[model samples]
Target: MVLYKTPNLKTILLNVFQDGILPYDIEDVLSLLVQKHYLMNKEQFLNYYKNDINQFWRDVASLGFKRDEKKATAESNDINDLKEYPEDNDNDFNIDDFFDSDEFKKRSDAEDIDNDAFKRNVSLIKDYQGINNSNERKNEKLNDICKINQRLVEKIAGKYEKMVRGTCLNIDDLIAFGNHGLLKAIDKFVPDMGYQFSTYATWWIRQSITRGIADESRVIRLPVHLHEKIMKIKNEERQYENEFGAIDASELCKNINMSDDEYWRFKSIAYQFDQITHLETIVGTEGDTELQDLLPITITVGSKSVPPDYMLTPEELFEKKELHDELENTLECLTSREAEVIKLRFAINKPDTMTLEEVGEIFHVTRERIRQIEAKALRKLRHPSKSKKLKDFIKG
Candidate 1:
């Protein structure tokens, strides 16, 4: 008789990676088995999975291992199928703009996806309820309609591109807003209204673009209703000025049917719209000072208060440069991958430092592996030859 015993989680993990199999390939699969009580003991796991690594990976691939391939395929198909379109009656349709709007180059790269791998991903995603027929059909229909009318959205969005330039928005942002509006139009559209769908969609698309600008282009976002009121007030003022010259605040308020308090309140809010200037804007006549430099900072020297001096003295700046160069030279001692890991871990040339798990995900490795790499890199950096200059710089 053969002896049988239940093995712990650690034993299973060790067995899974013992064959040089990536932890990513089997970690989730093992977790699922444990969580679902699929395997009662080590003997069963070894009998079913440990002996057949190929079958184990197929099971993982079926569970949507890393990426949801179905969604990517659907998106790629939507972009590809855009070439099949109805007759264009409008002469204003520029093929270049249409291609630019849809980002054809980016979408075409999706065609190069490995068929075998895609099939594996799709098979797994299907089993997980991640992509189903009903949802897929609905998405296909939505994408088709969006692509068909994409030219209309692009045309409307193009009109606002220059207007929103230098604000927190660009042409691409406007096009996204237009696409959102197109989707909304598709949902609420009544075909029996005896109006062209393009005409109806144009209103919604323009509304969406304007709303996006109002919501996003400002440092402080204002309510959409407030923005509408502001626009109404401005239109009234423009019309009133054209008919009768130079209307004061009280007169303007009466003309717009707003009370004095409301007019003053609106004016106060509107003033901020004009005050939007980037901190990077040059201020001094010599163009050496940014607007941020004018911001006040208090420094205490003895008992007296003084503004903090941001300008570095020649010697101090040279020392800082020397220290930075030395650090770079020390980092060069490490292998390229190790240097990149250290740089990313410490937020060097990056917006923020990443956690070991996040770094691992980027490199397609496990968190423990990333930890090992980080520790190894740190050990090298801590060596006397590497540490001595860094320590002196810190002390100085």
Candidate 2:
């Protein structure tokens, strides 16, 4: 990546002008250098130029080390040393006019000009004239096409405006994006390809509009791969539903060739597009409770009946104490390792429980071996001899 520093636009433009670069050629060079080589978009380049034309030129100049070195050398020269070219003062000035002048004829006759130098100069003049004529004809053709197709451009832009109506972008923004696509199509489309202009332009127009929406419309932007997958899945689902009625989850997963976990994770992300809601949104005709206030609270045995508060009742507190004691007594009947495994697995002393794999790791045993030990310990506790100790609690 090239890290560019802004250059002096006046100095850069002066150097380019001194080198006899045409305005149209300068524009082409700027577009190619900024968009292709520097990795900047057209809009960003335009904005930079609009802000400061001189600064824009300077920055563009910085892209070339040779240009900057030349500029530095020129800047170091004395003002009296710099000479202006005749072309700088007059657009109509021609080399042919210089050759046709009486002063030039007098000098040539007196100096005895070399035949080779005269032939070379004449060839150079012809080449310049040919290039200038070709450019003029090209400009005229482009202008005529643009003038004739202005209405067609507007129509295409309007169509895309309607298509992307509900996006974060307004109709004007969509139309602007569509117009850019249309302009690019005009520049690239070939009549020899045997396709209608509209047919070729449609893809570019829709691509530009949809890309804008996909990149800008969402509150939370998804990764491009995920977004494409979600869109593909949606399209497939619609096709399947139309042809085969309601689709099964397993069949849908198979069609997409995704595992259960992957499919569900994608489904959850896709569903978020519809699930977004504001906290202050009213839910019912009553118009009293907001969505946030209506969110469900899990109701336990002694949970509060009054809004936003909770406390344990006497009876529930006593029942919980009894249950704790019975659990401890039952655990005591098992071997130490068995008891420890059971407690960790069930989260008896912690808010989160350990998995079978975690318990196996702690005891340096296979998961299946830990399962066997737990089952055996449970069987021993459930035997008639051990059952008598907790018979009352079991009855309750």
Candidate 3:
């Protein structure tokens, strides 16, 4: 880790921005750098950086870091000697504070940083003694920059680690993403632009970490860019549901500027990320049953809810068997022809009930003759002794 003690702001900025002596040169460098690397235009670049370039001067002034341009011009025309950056004269303002963890805001500075290693790590950033036009020197400087800001990446990653709780990501993964953002920040850093590097780097660090979470939070990952829109739609749905008690798909599509087909496709993909509960997950007040207990073994179409055969309790199974046996015994009281006719008409132990004409064709009789046989069989079964047992199974 690159440890740095708080140094004079001028020395730090000068060492970092030595390649570009003028602010205008730094601007051009940044413009071409972002365009070549990120393919971002001016507006997109500002949005990505989370600040307007025009506001840099104002921000520096508010932070008490801005110096008078006239005084600097009069002091020296040479960039090497110009007082373009501020002297750290105020006790209240420290560049290191920019990298402080906002999570520990409630604690005092002494309480927040209790680590002895961190205390020992504090040292002034190494000067640009070896930095020059040489490739080795440039690479050395780049390593120095990355090392010095390593803690900043870790701190920023700490904040994001919470955002991705319950996700597949751990702190190490988040820190990796934060390091990528730190590299991007180093590439884009223009120290002469009047903002602390940490302040600027925070945006890139957060963007990279969040983009990583968005891309990898699910079993089936989505594009990093679409995550923003997906979050917007979800937030809108929550708000709409809270206000209206329900959501209208059409209204929600209009609100998010999505077509019905696109919204449904996204919804389907989103479902894939929903939490998976194990069949063994406990349920009920006493926690005596598993999740699978509540699920049906078989689903029948156009029928009232009834337990599948495998799900039936011992008593229910016994009752069903008894009723079926009783019905079979009652059918035996009829003549063979009458029993067969009744069985065919009522669909007993059959897939479908037969019409009078169908039964007549089967028995080689007319429909009227088959009907008389069915009526006679019903009259016999309607006798109190024969009907009494079957009546117990029917509800009023």
Candidate 4:
């Protein structure tokens, strides 16, 4: 018998979430790398994680997640649970504090300070004996600037992936850019000039990544050179008609001296149109309404409370009002706990109010017991005939 060792996407996702990087969509590229390299286990992952905690945070938690393990698996068949994202592990911030996590204000405050003496304090510089090119030497030496803060980069990347799509860049890339940026800063760095290496290097690393991303992004977008040519072709066609009159397709082809097939290809290239975006740009930004949008408007009005008597009309509203009244009468069959759970969960709509843990805490039961009850409740809700909707909703 053979025992195979390989980490799958699902396992990596669970492990990442368990490891305290916010439970969100895993980076597909990182998943591919993990699978290809056979470095899915904990020890190997620590090497990727420990050095670049901020970067790891961004890569793992890029998805704005609402569901915990129980909620995710309540609907999914293959997975039993989505591992819960850890509580604020470092106690650096509270779960309720959203803007504080990124710490933009503290940084902005630093810019207001003017301390020339404090600025030139380069005592942290490491000693390097032998090196050749000034740029290369500076690059190697620049690693000292953010040596400790690189760990913060790892954390952000690992935990904040859902928030920043560009975090597709992984740990090695972060370090490489940091090192490279530091080198550039070194070449530009002057003890005589008076500036802190740390601040400058931060800017350098950001520049390196931004430039790299622009280059990388340009690859995914149609090349600018191609777009330029396409635009020129279009302009020429416009000019062709403006100066030479409304020439038919055959006449334009005759002017261009291309055969029918080649002209068609050229025309196709020059006249390419972006469907949805083109309409949005042309008509002041409105496009086809998605099913997701239509309900939001009506739901918002209902949620804010359109008065029941003020809102209901005779025709369709009467039928809906009657049906809703009937449904509530049926809901009267459920117990208070069941009714509250059902209404809060589905009827009134709270996206993420009570976690299973929180619910268990309230009822003085184990989380596992809560799970069993929740599953039972959900199963009952799925087939309302099996149990009343409100009753089954609580069971879940």
Q: Write the per-residue lDDT of candidate 4 for residues 226-338, one digit (tens) a residue.
A: 44333334445666657755434455556656554555454443333212123223322465543221221111121222223323334446766655665566556566666
* Model 3: number of backbone collisions: 4
Between the candidate structures 3 and 4, which one is better when assessed by TM-score?
A: 3
- TM-score of every candidate: 0.34, 0.33, 0.37, 0.23
User: Backbone collision count in every prediction?
Assistant: 1, 3, 4, 36
Best by TM-score: 3
> On a 0 to 1 TM-score scale, where does candidate 1 land against the true structure?
0.34
Global CA lDDT of candidate 1, please? Answer: 0.57
Sequence-dependent TM-score of model 2: 0.33
Model 1: residues >4 Å from true position, as ranges? Answer: 1-140, 158-166, 188-196, 240-245, 278-396
| lDDT, candidate 3, 207-276, per-residue tens | 5666677767765676644555566666677787777766666677788798866765665445434332
Off by over 4 Å in 2: 1-176, 189-197, 241-245, 277-396
Q: Tell me the tens digit of each residue's lDDT in model 1 across 1-396.
A: 111234353344335444433343234444645555545544566575546544444443343333112211211122113232222221222322322243322323212333333233222323323334677766766666666666667867787786566677889999999898777766544332222345445555765777677778778777766766666666666675576664455566777688866755664455445345655588879988766444321111121111112233345567777887997999998999899899899876565689988999999999899899989999999999999988987753
- Count residue pairs with overlapping backbones in model 4: 36
TM-score rank order? 3, 1, 2, 4
TM-score of 3: 0.37
